[model samples]
Target: MAASSLFAALDKDGDGKVSASELRGCMAAALGEEEAAAIVAAADADGDGLLDRDEFLRLAREADQEADEDGRWRCLRVAFAMYADATAVEGEGAGQHITPASLQRMLSRLGSQEPGLDECRAMICRFDLDGDGVLSFDEFRVMMHDGLM
Candidate 1:
């Protein structure tokens, strides 16, 4: 979610700042009073015991950085789904093995400047664990996390 939207949710009264009460209420299960106070203290640069928009955005950015691994997994899953779904056959569903032809087809459909079949084959080869000349979901996921998507 956008920082502004999240800030709005945490700022309950639309006061343009999040107090300990607001923070605790919105994230009660995630932290205790001491933890919440510590976070507010750390981010409340002005020492007013609250998080303003800038402070909140910075906190959100930091939190996102902390969740980087989870975020990468989410992106990998979504991209893999798109690639797998692109070549789904009638009534066959998505997530079938991805061959170079399927990868090239997906790239072409998404307006690649030039969907190189050979390049796709090489990519699949690099990650294809079973060596069946295609990529299973696990291979595709590993390749994606390796930033080759």
Candidate 2:
């Protein structure tokens, strides 16, 4: 239940193995007994019909990764919007993506390895596909795919 809404009161034996009754108590409100049983069946992995800690942890990690992937895109969208707006104010490009100056400012705000304007310019040159000296959303996406964002 590391990443689940399992209650502490449910694992009565504290043996780190979840019985059907324990799962029913742990997840009934959120998943209902039937659904909880089904999930236990799917994630049990050993065909023992009991949810062991390792299987439960693996399931939790997968769910956590899924949540993180969704949250990453949402965060990227918001960050891009903010940077794009800042680029707009500077009359740089079309404001559809971050300009070098805007990217520099953002990095400075983040307070980590703040690059100089020259470095920022070089970064933009590396990522700008159309050679307009500015990044559009698609270009920004490519840059992020390269782990620059």
Candidate 3:
């Protein structure tokens, strides 16, 4: 991936510059606290307590090199299982089409206590390619390749 694109991914807010909190939040959201901390510490070569855009890009490149194929596949399977379960529930709309709003509602009722819209949007965007505002199986597969589960 291009360094700019990777930086955009980490930025999340589309801001012109990335702050310490933004980087920290992106890392935490993607991999949780411990892993995020480790990444920051390992990649912060200047020891300035924050990662500049170049440092973030370098770490992302290293991560791409160390890609865990098996783990990615397992994550894909788990995501598919969840999608299957969502579709199988009675009274849900027909077909494989799944909208962000509909999914947010469904997931909310399915024991996920997180009701935040950003969280729901983030989850849906992770899998919703084509900018169709919905997820099809193919889109889910692309997202699976990106390791979202």
Q: Give the alpha carbon lDDT tens digit for every residue of 26-137 in model 2.
A: 5667877788888788888999988777787787787789999999888777767766735354654455777778888888888868998888889889988899877777
lDDT string for model 1 (1-149, tens) is: 89899899899999899998889989999988888899999999899999999998999998989799788778777777666644667676456678787788788888987558899888789999999888878888787668777
Clashing pairs in 2: none
Model number with the top lDDT: 1
**Tens-digit lDDT track for model 3 on 112-131?**
88467677667777666677
Best by TM-score: 2
Q: How far is candidate 1 from the true structure (C-alpha RMSD, Å)?
A: 6.8
Model 1 score (lDDT): 0.84
Backbone N/Cα/C clashes per model: 0, 0, 0
Off by over 4 Å in 2: 1-9, 13-16, 85-139
Error of 2 at 102 (Å): 8.1
Ranking by lDDT: 1, 2, 3
Q: Could you tell me the lDDT of residue 25 within candidate 3? A: 77
lDDT of 1 at 71: 80
lDDT of each: 0.84, 0.75, 0.67
What is the alpha-carbon lDDT of model 3 when measured against the actual structure?
0.67
